[model samples]
Target: METDSDVELAVRPAPHPWLVLREHAHLVPMISLGGALGALGRWGLAQAMPHPAGAWAWATLWTNLGGAFLLGLLMSCVLTVWAHTRYVRPLLGVGVLGGFTTFSTAELDTRGLVAAGHPGEALAYVATSVALGLVAIMLGLGLGSALLRRGRPRRVTP
Candidate 1:
C-alpha cells in the first residue's frame, strides 16, 4: 500500500478546475438527498434528545459533526472499497453530505449566542465543535487509511 504522500501523489498528478465543478455536479443530488435525510434525522434526534440549553445550536452541531464523520467513513469506503467512480465522488460525497451538513448553520448559531449575551459559551461551543469535528475527521481518515491498505485489489486468476 502507498503511504499518505504516495496516495496523494498518485491522485494529484493532474489538475483540473472544471473537474471540481463536475465532481460537484455528480454530488449535488446526492448531497441534497443527504441533506433531506439528515434534516429529518436531526429533527428526530432533537425531538428525542432535546438539548439542555440551545436546541438549534446543539442540533446543528450534532448534525454537522455526525455528517463529517459519516463523510469520512463514506470517502474511506468509496476510495478503498467501492473504488470511487467518476460520478460517485462528486455527487454522493461532495454534493449530498456536504449539503446535508453545514458550516453556515454553525456560524448562525454562534451569532445567535453572541447576540443573546453568551459570548463565552458561544466561543466555547465553536471551539469544541471545531476541535471535535477535526478529531472526528481524523478518526474517520485513520480508519479509512487502514481500509485503503486492506482493500488494495487482490490478484485475479488469469
Candidate 2:
C-alpha cells in the first residue's frame, strides 16, 4: 500500500530522452510549417526595420530572440491551457516550437562567443537562457493550472 505522497512520487513523470527523439518524428512537419512562417516573418522585419550598412546578421539575431521569447510565451499558454487535454503538450511544445528553433544554431552561437573572447558572457548567456526558459515554462504551467482550477465552479450546499 502507498501513501498519497508515495503515490504522487510513484506517478511522477520524468522527461524521456526517447520522447524528445520521438517528438522529432512529428517535428518534421511542425518545423516545416513554423520555419516557413518564421522565414516570412524575418523577411518582413528586414524590409520593415531600418538597418546599418553591412549588418545582414542583425535580422537573424532579432528573429531568433523574438522567436525564443514568443515561443516562451506561446509555449506557456499552450502548456497551461490546452495542456489539460492529452497529447497537447508534446504536439505543440515538442513538435512545433522545438522544430521551429535551432539548438544547433544556439550551440554555434556559444562557440562564437568563446571565439570572440567572451567565454564568460557565453557561459552566462547559456545559464541565463536555460534558467529563464525553465522558469518561464513553470510559470506558464502554474498560471494555466490556476486558470483551469478556478474556472471550475465550486459546489456549495444551500
Candidate number of the best lDDT: 1
User: What is candidate 1's CA lDDT for residue 102?
Assistant: 73
* Tens digits of lDDT, candidate 1, 31-106: 6675576566666765765654443477778877887887787777786667846666655576567665777878
- Candidate 1 has an lDDT of 0.72
Residue 24, candidate 1: how far off, in angstroms? 7.7
TM-score of 1: 0.64
| CA deviation > 4 Å runs, candidate 1 | 1-31, 46-56, 147-158
Looking at model 1, residue 56 earns an lDDT score of 41
The best candidate in terms of TM-score: 1
The residue ranges of model 2 lying beyond 4 angstroms of the native Cα positions read: 1-91
Per-residue lDDT of model 2, residues 1-158, tens digit only: 64676444556577798887685675556546655665566667666765543323344344455556656656556655565664554555544555445545555666667777778866875675566656655665566566667887899999
Name the 10 consecutive residues with the lowest summed lDDT in model 1: 6-15
State the local distance difference test value for candidate 2: 0.58
Give Cα-based local distance difference scores for all models: 0.72, 0.58
TM-scores, in order shown?
Answer: 0.64, 0.52
Model 2 clashing-pair count = 0
